[model samples]
Structures are given as C-alpha cells and as structure tokens.
Target: MSRPRVQFMRRPGRLMLSAVAAFAVVQLAGCGKQAAPDAETTATLIQPVARLDLKVAKAAPGSRSGEEIYQSVCVSCHGTGVLGAPKTGDAAAWAPRIAQGFDTLTQNAINGIRGMPPRGGGADLTDIEVQRAVAHLANTAGGNFTEPPVGQ
Candidate 1:
C-alpha cells in the first residue's frame, strides 16, 4: 500500500501569503489620523534662525560718508588692526600714523601700504572716498582729521 505524500510547494505559497498580510497590517496600523500643527508651532518650525539689519547712512547721491566708507571697506583690517593696521579707537597704535599727517595717510591708503591693498582693497572707491575713510579711521583713534567733502 502507497502512503499519501504532503505537497511541499503549497506550503511555500501559504507562507508568502502570510508574510504579505502581516506587512499590510503593520502599514495600515500607522495610517491613523494625527493632530494638525498649530499656526504658531508651524511658524516656529519654519522661521529664520538669524537676521541682519544694514543701516545705511543718508548721503549725497553716489557719495558715501567717511563713516560709511570705513564701515563698508576699511573696517575689515582697521577695525581689528589686522596685519599691523591700526585698530579703530586705539590712540597708541594710531599715534605714529597720525604724526605722519593727513596727507601722508591718505596717500598711503590710496597707494596701498604694506599689507593694505590699493584703496584699502576697495578699487571701486574714489580718491575722495579713500580720503574720507582715512579721516574716519584716524579720527576714531584720537587723531583730529577732517573728512574730505563728498563729490570732490
């Protein structure tokens, strides 16, 4: 007498079906409704981390003031006295340069002295603008220098 043989191929198909059903149940379980974000919470999530405020001084058309020029251009080096450049408001560091007089300082700024590039690295700055920036820098460090009039 021959015994009945169990079907091994049908067992694999049933196992695959079971696995697919389990996956679908798990995915459906996570599809439940969630609370919508409130206006303040949404805004906070998307808000900028930092902001910048540029306050430009009022000046004549196409002309920047001594302070304006200094803030924009000369502040990089002179503000911190990088590479022997005199820092703003440092009387001792500026004493020798101030002793050299306004004309000499303006010339150095225009021609580039030592580590400073021509026009304090602002090639777009005009000669008068350079003079104005020089005056602003020198004055901050206890020197009495007049800023050249704009439009010169």
Candidate 2:
C-alpha cells in the first residue's frame, strides 16, 4: 500500500505536519514551508472558522476544541498507539482508521471498539461531548469534519 502522507511542522520551514494538529489536515496544503511554531503556546489552537445556526458555534471560553477533547480523553492511547489504537500525528496510522468512516467511529467511541474501551475509556462524558472530542482528534488526524457543517 502507498504510504499515507505525513505532515510535520519543524522549525522555520519545517514542513508542517498536518496530522494530530490536523488543523489544516484535510487540505494538507502540501506546503514545504512550516510556519514558525507559535512561541510560548502549549498547543496549537482551534478557533471557529465560521459556524452554522447551531449553538455549538457559541461554545464558551475554555470550552474545549476537538484537539482539546482528544487530549483530555482520546490522546492517552491515540497519542501513543496503545492497545493497537492509531498513534496521533501519524497520517499512515489514521488513514485506514478514517476509512472506517465517521458514523462507525462515533459509535465505536460511544460504545467501545476493540482495544478502545468506550470514549477511549471515559464513561461519564456525554455522547455529544465525546463526539466533539472524536472530531477534534479525527480532524487533527485529517478527517473532513462538519458536525456543525456550515450553512445549516
């Protein structure tokens, strides 16, 4: 199988890796130049590009992003590929996984997939909440997401 594209943001001109930070993942711009890593920031951030008529667009300050959700819940295993879970920031790892599609992924998280134990192991979080968390990671890892698809 062809190797899945992997994007990594290095120093000034470090080819930006569009993986876990799947921030720009779908586009994967294929840019050879990496933007200077933002200084003094603990993590790459997620800001609203635009929103639909849904209230999800109006999430409060400190309301987590998909990336944040991944970090909080999914990352522990995904970040390291523990228990056969895909590793974060690895497009190859995510490629086949994304092939499983969103609905299935969501259900897997809501219930529990093999190796993964429901919401990556958190049971108390709501389905919607876990959904956002899932999108964050999926998007970061490069999945065309639109839970709040525009123009609703």
Q: Whole-model lDDT for model 2 versus the true structure?
A: 0.68
Best by TM-score: 1
List candidate 2 stretches off by more than 4 Å: 1-64, 147-152
C-alpha lDDT values of all predictions: 0.87, 0.68
TM-score of each: 0.61, 0.52
RMSD of 2: 29.4
lDDT for each residue of candidate 2 in 1-152, tens digit (9 for 90 to 100): 98765554224345444244576655576867978877645343554566567454434333555665676678789887889888776778777777888887789888897888876776656666666776667776787765532122
Worst 10 residues of 2 by lDDT: 9-18
Please, what are the lDDT tens digits per residue for candidate 1 over residues 1-152?
Answer: 98776775648888788899999999999998888879998998898899798997655543998898888888999888799888899999899999999999999999999999999998788888888988888998898988888767
- Scored against the true structure, residue 122 in model 1 reaches a CA lDDT of 83
- Sum up the clashes in candidate 2: 6
Clash pairs detected, candidate 2: 7-17, 8-16, 8-17, 9-17, 22-140, 66-136
